[model samples]
Target chain A: MWMGQSSVDFIMAGCKLLDEGNVQSFLDNTDIVLTDCDGVLWRGNQVIPGAQETIEKLRKLGKKVLFVTNNSTKTRAEYVTKCASLGFPASEDEIISSSYVTAHYLKYIVKYTGKVYTVGPQGLAQELNAVGIPNFGTGPDVAENWKFEDYTTLPLDPEVNCVVVGFDKDFSYVKLCRATAYLRDKGCLFVATNTDTGLPVNGRFIPGTGTIVAAVSEAAERRPDIICGKPHLPIFDTVLKLHNVDPKRCIMIGDRLNTDIELAHNCGLGAALLVLTGCATLEEVRQKQSSNSIADQRLVPNFYLPSLAQLGTLIDSLK
Target chain B: MWMGQSSVDFIMAGCKLLDEGNVQSFLDNTDIVLTDCDGVLWRGNQVIPGAQETIEKLRKLGKKVLFVTNNSTKTRAEYVTKCASLGFPASEDEIISSSYVTAHYLKYIVKYTGKVYTVGPQGLAQELNAVGIPNFGTGPDVAENWKFEDYTTLPLDPEVNCVVVGFDKDFSYVKLCRATAYLRDKGCLFVATNTDTGLPVNGRFIPGTGTIVAAVSEAAERRPDIICGKPHLPIFDTVLKLHNVDPKRCIMIGDRLNTDIELAHNCGLGAALLVLTGCATLEEVRQKQSSNSIADQRLVPNFYLPSLAQLGTLIDSLK
Candidate 1:
């Protein structure tokens, strides 16, 4: 009945939340578990040796496990593709990206029935249209080119409702000129997908959407109107609703301390399990748990794990 | 009746182009005609020294005149409004602003179907939309509220095909971020209405859209998609078409030597004017002419007068 055994068990068994009493109560009450990707399951590409098996083991014990990510550029489909390619079993609904949250937020404000310009990929644009926010040019063989300066000359036309910023490399003088011009005249809205600084692929660092977002910030003289992913609304709430469990009864788990741990704490969900992989290194977790913390202390993970597979009896004992 | 004394008549009567050439040939032959607005009979107020009436004088006498200016933000409509208000009897088609030329050039290479975000007043944005471009959001509402960075993340989207740059003093961090982010996105284009470094209002200097555009460029790492306005095209071409005449017979009559003179030279019409009223002074014109002689020689006027009212005798002599 133990299902499997590995070094992951010792890590989980010895886990201690900073507020031990609160964590214990949380463990006793929660029926659902939310997990962050990257650090929890793998580092760069080599899975933490037993992540998949540990997840499978946890599921067999009747604990609902979920995964979340803050990277906004990739769509749910893209995330699914990545997971599948990474040899993980994932369904579209099982994963979330910042882009998803952004789309949902826009829907709350108004439907974009006009043009939308971005420093992002096709995925982010597709998300907007998917939610009834019609794109600027939606017809076949539609050929249109515009410069930033053109916006200033024609601000009230109502053809453009929003400006979505994501990751882009083609930033240039011409585009900036036109975009800012429009900003001053019509007062177009601004929204950012996510704030990840960089993404690791093939053992190298590639610029993330955050860098692009920051660049826009430097020009526009402000930050995102709203950030759609991580520690924001709906992502955590949606997951809780799906399982019919209260947030207080849910245990959020993830590899990155910042996204997973912070999200869980911000939403009143209990306990974050820090795994060493993805964006944050093990050394970083130790650093935060020790003095130089920019974040609030209550958000710290309840438990620490070298690998989920490193836990054995704790899986059974927790139940 | 000779409005001016017979003494002025000989000077006006003996004018070479009117006496020896036909309208088309004379227009083609004359390099430039400079005039003033005050004494000229404009639509009403004060075409001032030689503004509109001077152009009328040149037309009957077979001289070519090019209108120019230093006020970069005003669109052709604004110019038309001023001319009409001043009783200049000119169409929006006849007058030119640095803004008009800026918008004109942007329309040429860029293709866009979405809403353009703009900063300046209605004249600028309206001018662009009239030619078939659209803009995002409207006055003090969305475009004003949304910063450039937020443009990427929200429901509106980041795949902006183009951005139009203009001036806005309240421009904040959010707008800069959105624009910067949008520009970095691949394939998005940028444009500026004008490259004015600063704006003059109430005797104080403020950074113009050019400064903001440059900031965006540095962040995004590219040059302007295009700079419209001032000696640029599609503007001059539009003006020529308004007269229902060929370019060989068209002229630009403006107050500023650089904008008017340079505009004419660039368009293959002719550059010839300077007034103490605009940004470039007579001293500046003289220095510029001597320094860059190609367009510089053309900068000198065939006719230099204190005002246009002195042309009555000259006008009758043409008959």
Candidate 2:
């Protein structure tokens, strides 16, 4: 994923990159731009300026606009609310984040004859329910909801074909044990929402869905079939499908190399615009770019931007 | 996995079950009763009563005997040494187990490559060496010599077609990380020695090879392909292939049902005897039996005795 440039440098550098022209050859022909939310829009709650205006400009140009994120803690409604509060008018329909992507991914791969054993919050379940995927799991209202016995562990029947894992701070051992046993006996599939490892916010890093997923993975001996969210594929697919845009015309924008930049690299899409205000630094970006892990070709960012406020004037240059 | 049954009880029970009729049936007709050392003869050199005499009686009848254990924890020389000390006259040729089984299994599955990144002890390495399977692991005196980079956190790699997880207590985190990575990336095969969760000696429980194997399985999110030692198939297969004994005429005996009883159950061979002196109790045996977790409709022991020394009276009854 792209390690974002700071807002100031972002606008200045992005303008230069755009003005440098080959990039405009990129944006001018681009039909869809799947932007990540965590590091792109606002640091946490506050707007980074020009985020709304950029969305407006893209929409005014009749471009498909979708905010795909790996974070599933917030539901679609919360995302819309957050977008509105940040001056960008958003609807549940306008966003295709990891949370939503995971829900859709589940529909495509997980064959559910009955309710699914969900491990995320309302947005995820709602997305599943909207698709008529029966959400079979119980919540806190049903404490001890997940028991080994409650699961069809041994000689598992075909009624339950999938188990979806997401961010749940209080996940229990019983669920893990059941998953392990079920996978062991029946060989049912496993899928996770994302693999962000950890989420960074307000200068503090908390264990992301990846960490939680890894914990269960360490016990179950089965990696999820698909990591549905950002830095993976489902969200990107949904963005393109929903926008009806050719991937060649798509650009991914984000504030981190791990989430935003890596997504663009993995997917056959345009370069990322890494903003420095999020998770990684210039030094880290440079070091990671040279590392074999991310690969030289996979490391991307068409522009190094400090922030979006500077981009407003640059858009004027286009006129 | 037959638990708590002394090794001898395990044998007698398995012999009697498959033999049917009075105890005389086993004594009269049985030719070769191959025994795996890990869960069968002794866990790690503590004697299970009746093992020596039981083996002696069977040998006296001109039965060809082999001490097969999947555990590569000791070398052929070491096994012979251990057996001789236990009052069983064992030679390198007479002692056969998983190292031999795995070496053959490797040849049957994957052609002998240039080198192998072994993860067990000298016995395992020697077994492979004898079979012309080049050992790529470090020497015994090398002091934690296995390189950590060979393994990974994602246990998926096409290169790692087979991994042997035996007894390696100095298990560092790096080994686990690499093993996990290999399992995930390659979907590589894995082979375990035994499934005994814990080993007992001096009335204390010590984590056995199975515990370590479980950790690898957990980290890799993939179960090993075969548990090579007793109760699984490798050791038994070696004996059967070498001794020319029919499954019906054979009997398996061990302390743990997870291994010994499991072997008899899986093979449709002779009976399984539950002895209380080693791993599990008779009570557990009955419980597992009711659940059908134990093998079904095979040779089950016609008798459950604490030790095989009592077999003289049992033999008298047979007469």
Could you tell me how far off, in angstroms, the CA of residue A207 lies in candidate 1 after the best superposition? 2.0
Clashes of 1: 155
Docking quality category of candidate 2 according to DockQ thresholds: incorrect
Instruction: Give the per-residue lDDT of model 1 (tens digit) for A1-319.
Output: 1112221232233346323334335446667777767766766556767777767766776667666777655678888887777667778877766666667667754444556666565667677767766653211111034322333343333566566766543433334433443343335777767666555555434445665565455445556666666665556644654456766666677766556767766676645666555565556655565654446353356676556665433454453
The DockQ assigned to candidate 1 is: 0.02
DockQ-based CAPRI category assigned to the predicted complex of candidate 1: incorrect
Where in model 1 is the C-alpha error above 4 Å?
A1-28, A108-115, A136-157, A169-179, A185-187, A237-244, A290-299, A311-313, A316-319, B1-319
Interface Cα root-mean-square deviation for all models: 10.7, 14.1
Model 2, B108-165: lDDT tens digits are 5456464455556566777778778775432321213222122212233344555776
- Per lDDT, the best of the predicted structures is 2
